[model samples]
Target: MVSNLAGGRRPRSGVEPGTQLGALEAYAAQAHGYLTAGDDELSQLAGLLRPLILESWLRGVRAGIDPMDPGSERGLRGADLARYRDAHAIAPLLPLIDKLLVQDTARTGLIVVVADQFGRVLWIHGNPEQVAVATEMGVREGDDLSERRVGANAVGLVVRTGRAVWVHGPEHFLHRMHQLTGAAAPLHDPDGRLVGVLMLAGGGRVAKPEILALVKATATAAEMDLLLTAMRAVQPAPRDPAPVADGPLGLDVLGLGQPQLSKGGERIPLSQRHAEILLLLAEHGEGLGADHLALLLDDTDLDNGTIRAAMSRLRTVVGAALIGSRPYRLRAHIATDVEALRAALDSGDVESALQLYAGPVLPRSTAPGIVDLRDELRVRLRTAVLRSGDAAVLRRWTAGADGRDDAGAWVAYRATVDRDSTLYAQIEAKIRVLDRRLGADATRMQRSRS
Candidate 1:
């Protein structure tokens, strides 16, 4: 970042030691007025407002968003809103957010806000009265608080710069928001993609340093949860992919090709249904019952009889000695290609993981469990590959079935290779074709709005 990025010789709004709150707010209001009125004395404004806030104010001015008027801003509502948030990658980690932020703020008058990378608020929980106050300031669920949409605010600042930020009182461009303060930090997925933002806001003590610290900590916890969830596929299964003499088993469920089993060093043929069951069993050591398998094996939820029949046939093929009753788990310890992929990922061996990832697991299987597992594995490997920034690994992935049409992978590949190389032009051609499909997600993931 530029030394003068935040204006007053530092990239922040440095409050002087012992500066009164009233004085700071007065100076902040003056700076906001200057920016709104098209004042060019940036040096004077820089002394009062933060460089980040000034930048946001400039964009707000360029967009012609009046400081006196919030203008009309709408977000997903009702079922559209529910469906969107449920489908989001952040959906699984809401519980973690609750434990880390909301519960502790019960009596603090602070409200927690979770917003997609687009700055659209997805969830808001806090003290009832404070929540209502936030709602009055347009911090309700489904509202867009992006820099371009709502000017300078913690959520908007985090979106613009992908960092933890705070917006106190008069720092907000809209007059209505001057009653509260907010601190927000970006929440990223396992692969380092910014998925959303976590924030805390209130009318009291919201500007305290601990507030930003807490927001940053909670955001980190959320990212770690994403990583752990991705790693859950790595249960207690033996790391060795080869079948061992200790009554161990092996299963291969990746690729567009048929899934197979390896027993006593001999490849064994298996039906698609059998493959799905074994893969699920291998990933889940504790095993699953027919009733549970019924839901996972099909969208319509197969009957107990059908699930029993499939398990019965599977038992015979793999030998009953290798299988158990009741929950119907594999009696012998097992290793799988999926586990190997996770090992590669866990060790940060992105290249090895890329090499092991021949394709998505049982790509043709419509079984719900298999689909979720497929996505988990694919997403982990893909995230690792992109973050690795290894040209060869990226090239290999782009050549594979899954990555061939992956626009994001191609774009990352473009960055790692020589700009003047023939390969660069080739990647460019590929990106152009897939560019339209690249960023139709969460409003503004590909680029932060001004």
Candidate 2:
């Protein structure tokens, strides 16, 4: 059913709500034509859209999303969904969510949607009529609401932009979606990591400015509840150290440097062994067994006593409550430098991502898990830099600690940089030196094989 937002009323421009919406709907329709042609940078498109929406359009174009037929391309159901939902960080706050927001949205003609960082709908609730209306628009539970699925939506834009926003009629890439307006806010943990999103979708009733404020307020409350729950779960050890945040602790182990943890602005130094254990725990948020951790920590036959001794020392430093017993897991929230870098890359902010890369994760650590993590982070970051194809970005990357010796990156730099410049000679020299070094290594390997 088409919403009554835009009909026979000749919408006049100004600050009036209906007038602005009508004008936006007209701009969106005009923009939609340019979008389908895969050209978001047309000179004619400038000043016709808000900066944020324009940015999202660029991302959608790069992702090859078909604006004309944007449907949710992925979802989960039944047992698989149950397992994933239960394991999600937002799982614990389900009750708080229901009590705080769900109860009120019922029969109110507004549907509440809670989505994970990836824009997968984890929970959706509201009036049956509204629910049915939403279901017809492909906003069902487990559906992926990301740009790749349904272009230019509030949830997708929030996930990409990491900020709260309201998507008005016609602003959505799907023409049929013009019937609904969606307001959404990102929920964050203590360390500023995106935990999830809270959103409300409807028609004229949703156009109220208060709806956006309501979503933001509820999101804040939800985050507070998460903090409280994490705090309540702590079992601080007898030897009291400085008080840390109640939820997961902030872990900083990027590059070839000493690992650190934090309680807000206060930095806590961590021993190498402690960092390794903490890294493993953070990697496996669900939990890890003693036997499994031992294997990841070393190839040698490591005994439980050694692992116990390490845990004992770690518990004393971070407090026992931060590390759960049983199958070991990090009880507090862990905000890592690695996570921040990935978030930047996800949002298509390669420059910020490059700035966050100090080096490979734990560049000096030889532990199996740390080594794997270092390679994974380095490769991911390198790939993102290469894919960016921005000459300035390539220049910045090739000069960094991680990419200084990266011959492939230097080659890419040469391709992008001007041949008429003095820097051209320097880049060429560096590439040749790297190529020679690589040639020597390959020749040595061939001789060894013979």
Candidate 3:
């Protein structure tokens, strides 16, 4: 028998020992009532829930989800499901997952569920009876079990927190899900990107600490299998003109925070200035001369020699051949997160584009060009999303840090939703908050003027 981590059935801190279930149920009831009634006092009553669980409930409420609804609201179906499965990166790991977990899950009367990074259940296996029950509850393949769709669950919570978690009984936001318990862990590709979540789900009896450990171990094994598979698939390249780094060059510069470059699974650290230069060069595939680059690099006039010295240092850090000198361009193809985001946007794949855009481009950069590029990309992406008039997409944007303060997105979201809906009320509240903030700012400005 597995020992309970929080001393039994209570997955979070600050709960009374014997009243864990009661507390969770009470909190869930309070949250439900507050959301349904559009009361802002929910936060005051959230003391019974763990911070993470409470946050998940708030997100669900903001999304206008009905806790009583039994089915998932979005997912791929039939032919679409088939196509997605075939193209998914996790496809190769399914057999390995089956070998490791299916028999055990079947015997234990548990369901093994695999979901993509976005929380869409791609596959489920286990005892036929349990599978049927889960299917009836909308846990079948192709159903979106994301927090925004079906409230908190092991799969969605793991994706959201990027950690192993167990959601038991009343910890679930949806009333119908109170009958089930789940433990899940997020899986990552070799490059450290989230691939999906691997979960073990059953009744409340499955909430033991050992079960969480088992799910984590299984997730690790599957990730190792994926990594080994990826390694075997890559053929040896004969030789390169320049000294090649171990793996492909990957650059991530979306956020001002911790921009990184990886080569052969090793991190090559960059100075703030070098990061700015590389980002500028990557953005301008056609290449820029030293003078032009210097101008972009700083607002004031910078000498050509200063720019040349910086480029020389950068070449030494990367390879000399990788940085071409004539027009100043990268010789080899470098994969960048920003370019991927742009490609997705250009292809009209707004969801993909949003997923790829982690944050603004080198957000910390004070350089004129980098700042302009960042703003331009942000504006263009928002314009495209608003133009599409997709409520789901708009909600996703408004829910993120970048869009939380965006009054335009709130207006757009409100316009797209029905006025009588809970979602409309939520957006209206957000708009009111924005209005109050704007009013305060205007008042301050008037006082300053006087």
Candidate 4:
């Protein structure tokens, strides 16, 4: 007999179908009510889900996600989307994925979603009818399926735990996602680093142990394909030579407050000192000698041993081959967030630049080199935005955490925008606050002068 697996409970042998269905329905109702009421302590409630699912739900609630909202966070689009897809290391494996999973799953009333390690969906394919349903549920290309945004699901969970997961109806944290089931497995590169997640999602009928097994098998095949591709792509080259190709050694320093290196789809964390060194090396494509690097690091009193020791430690994480020691340079073509922001600004794309600027780079770092680099980037980006004279851009900049206290940006916004506009009132209020603070400062200065 076909058993209902909606509540993640397998029917016991010889249990009456009517009785089992009734129990499942009652359990789902209770769980839904408990979650809707914002009560996270599921231990007190009987007939709830497994501990893993409960924990995921609690995290979702803490992230301030609305269980009723099906919309996922959207990321890249248009030309930017195209460029990202083309540059992604997984691009070559997509066709193989479509043939092995998407084509077959579409006919089986299921959808195949391929998300990056960060939980941004790059591709969504399925039968026409099911695709429409998925879109209506806010599942689309570029949607961020990260746990912080979309709550618990196969994609987010697999990325989070680096393990295969089967989320059945009501097992999902979001109430709107209760009608669907998802089985996802994390795809790892040849080095065993997670590259992305492969997910198979369908309605209640498809949630089963066998489905999870199939997903795991498919994920394994995709990993092997990726491994083979990488192997074929690599070629021997001269030592300490400039990168032959624009590889995927992407560095993100903005907003992260610490640098994150993205290589072969894996995010490699870097120490503050390491981040400063990498940024310096990337900025100076010609390379910086050990002595030069030491000076930049504000270690003038120390010798080359200190720089060499730090570089030696960084080599283990970023690969020795990627770091050339002759003059201390990045052997790979490193892409940086700062470069992207600059490019946007250079092309008169103030809005694009603002979007690219996540925040001040390595905000807390007091290292001399880092401080100079950070301040230069922040000042340049802000100057370009203010100079744009676009009220919309100014308004967006002022609304951000960094720009909220920027009195000049607010003043520019006020002058550029229509006085009678609704946003003007908000800007004026901020201006008034700034004026009061300035007045108080002037008063204090007068007392100090006395």
RMSD (Å) of each candidate, 1 decimal = 12.6, 14.1, 17.9, 20.3
Model 2 residue 195 distance off true place after TM-score fit, in angstroms: 1.4
**Candidate 1 at residue 7, lDDT?**
35
Question: How well does model 3 score by local distance difference test?
Answer: 0.73
Model 1, runs deviating above 4 Å: 1-12, 16-20, 39-44, 71-73, 234-450
Task: State, as a TM-score between 0 and 1, how close model 4 is to the true structure.
Answer: 0.51
Clashing pairs in 1: 6-51
lDDT of 3 by residue, 181-300 (tens): 888899998877677898888886676777788888888998898889879977753333444556688788886578777777887888888888888888766566775576467744
In the range 1-450, model 1's lDDT, one tens digit per residue, is 212322343323465312345555666777766555553443355456555676577567756777887545455567656765786778888888999898998667789999986577889998778888888888898777877667898998887778898888888989889997888999997777677999898864777777788889999988998999889867665432322353456888878778888887778888999999888777656566665565457645356688888888998897766766567677666688889988999999998888788788888897766765676678678888888888899899989887887767877888998899998999888776654443222112221221
Between the candidate structures 1 and 3, which one is better when assessed by lDDT? Answer: 1
List clashing residue pairs in candidate 3.
247-264
Per-residue lDDT of 1-450 in model 4, one digit per residue for the tens? 223335556433223212344445445556667667644333322234444555577567656788788563445556545655565657788888887888778888899988876566778888788877877666677666767567888788887677888776666767777777788889988887676888888876555667778888888998999888779977754556554543588988888666889887888988888888888898777676664465456522235688889999999988887888767888887899888987897898889989998988777665545655676677677888778888889889988987886777887888887789987898788777864654333222222222
How many angstroms is residue 41 displaced in model 3 relative to the true structure, after the best TM-score fit?
A: 3.2
Candidate 4, which segments miss by more than 4 Å at Cα?
1-28, 39-47, 70-73, 237-450
Off by over 4 Å in 2: 1-19, 38-41, 70-73, 236-450
Q: Between the candidate structures 1 and 2, which one is better when assessed by TM-score?
A: 2
lDDT of each: 0.74, 0.72, 0.73, 0.71
Give the clash count for each candidate. 1, 5, 1, 0
